[model samples]
Target: MADHLRDRFTAFFQKNVANPVMRRNPLQTLLETTGRKSGQPRRTPLGGSRVGNEFWFVSEFGDQSQYVKNIQANPRVRVRLRGRWHSGVAHLVPDDDPRRRLQSLPSFNSFGVRTFGTNLLTIRVDLDN
Candidate 1:
């Protein structure tokens, strides 16, 4: 019951508050996914690190996340890193340990993910050269 309520509350806060503010920030990393139903572009602020040609992040809500669902429909995506957009293919890495993975990411963001996240899942985006 608490988890359900927390999910609902966090989803509302993220969609209504945090995301809007973060999206407007030039420095915030963002993931762009094609909407499956609307056939439109959707951008979500994310916390991740770029390693070589791959960008790594974890979805706090895992498969229940709308962005993850969009990725399921289309793996092709874009990521804004350091104010530049990069085209990439998003991959869900269920085999990766999300908790462990978070330890290697940005501390502040990782802490939020650990606190508010109900279902942790790792996502990897391999950028095109």
Candidate 2:
């Protein structure tokens, strides 16, 4: 990653996404999903939190995220929450749910607003390991 882009994204994760309190705690979880076409695993680091017993994550890039689509068409996933990777599955928010309210919130980057892309895929996570 280029220095400038890396610095900017780091700022977003630190300031806007990752909680200040959780920074010191090993509470983060990363989801690594495979490309539906290639079958090879692609790891995309994300800031995750729990909603009840289920895990949740907001995509920084919305639906245009290849990994998001991949996981949508294929629910199985792999995760690395605390320096370890574990295989799991991911699912999208059903259109019928009231949780769809999240779509209205203004998206954010560390510096400013984030324009949503086509996929608009906001989904909950299910872990097997």
Candidate 3:
């Protein structure tokens, strides 16, 4: 029941997150990770896309979100996108190129700064090849 409630809560927030994109498309990715300190699973929902070999997650808001730090400490991430789940590791771009390019893409926007304030990371999700 708890997980069900959490899912509903997440869905509710995703609808009310003041996003013009979600207003049209309600489906997005929920990136789950392990908290470095708590050692518990933490989930962050965002509007993102998949690149060649990795998944790109961006959030212009929620600058102080702990999930970002968790990913920094442990890049391994599990993502649920459009009902399909994928597991991989993410590496922060720590530069402007990836973020700038993501912003230019039609799927994502300028929300990459929340992770590093313009230092957008090209989170390289390591997949099982």
Candidate 4:
């Protein structure tokens, strides 16, 4: 499939199917980024792991992801991990190897990301203590 077509299809499935289900699960990890245009909090269910005071994840669509665009607009964000919310600053690490980073994250999500992601990008969130 062409990248644009795949992206569109995947985004549709995620928005209409996957995300709604995931968001309802209290155990699901979530990233809340301010809407770049609307200025409202937008919660996106994600798969990642917390290490020390930082949380790391790979964006399946790189800068093309809506949350990533929001991060570019406003780096300050909130993350919900294991049912607790933490405030943080989000950063896009273009230099990081997303494929290698995915190896360190949850296998299930990494699998989906690797399968559907066309342009993987690494994201790091420095959590507030």
- How high is each candidate's TM-score? 0.99, 0.55, 0.60, 0.97
On lDDT, the candidate that comes out on top is: 1
User: Ten consecutive residues with minimal summed lDDT in candidate 1?
Assistant: 120-129
Off by over 4 Å in 4: none
Q: How far does residue 10 in candidate 1 sit from its true spot (Å)? A: 0.3
Off by over 4 Å in 1: none
lDDT score, candidate 4 = 0.97
| Predicted candidate 3 versus true structure: per-residue lDDT over 1-129, tens digit per residue | 664565455445555673335434435567778999998987665556666666665543222346668887787888876767788886665454655555654443444243324323445456533
Descending-lDDT candidate ranking: 1, 4, 3, 2
Q: Model 2 segments beyond 4 Å from truth? A: 1-28, 51-53, 94-120
Which is the winner by lDDT between candidate 1 and candidate 4? 1
**What are the Cα lDDT values of the candidates?**
0.97, 0.56, 0.59, 0.97
- Cα lDDT of model 1 by residue, 1-129, tens digit: 999999999999999999999999998999999999999999999999999999999999999999999999999999999999999999999999999999999999999899999999999999995
Deviation of model 2 at 59, angstroms = 1.5
In terms of TM-score, which candidate is strongest?
1
Better of 2 and 4 by lDDT: 4
Superposition TM-score, candidate 1 onto the true structure:
0.99
Clashes of 3: 3
Candidate 3 Cα deviation (angstroms), residue 41: 1.0
Per-candidate clash tally? 0, 2, 3, 0
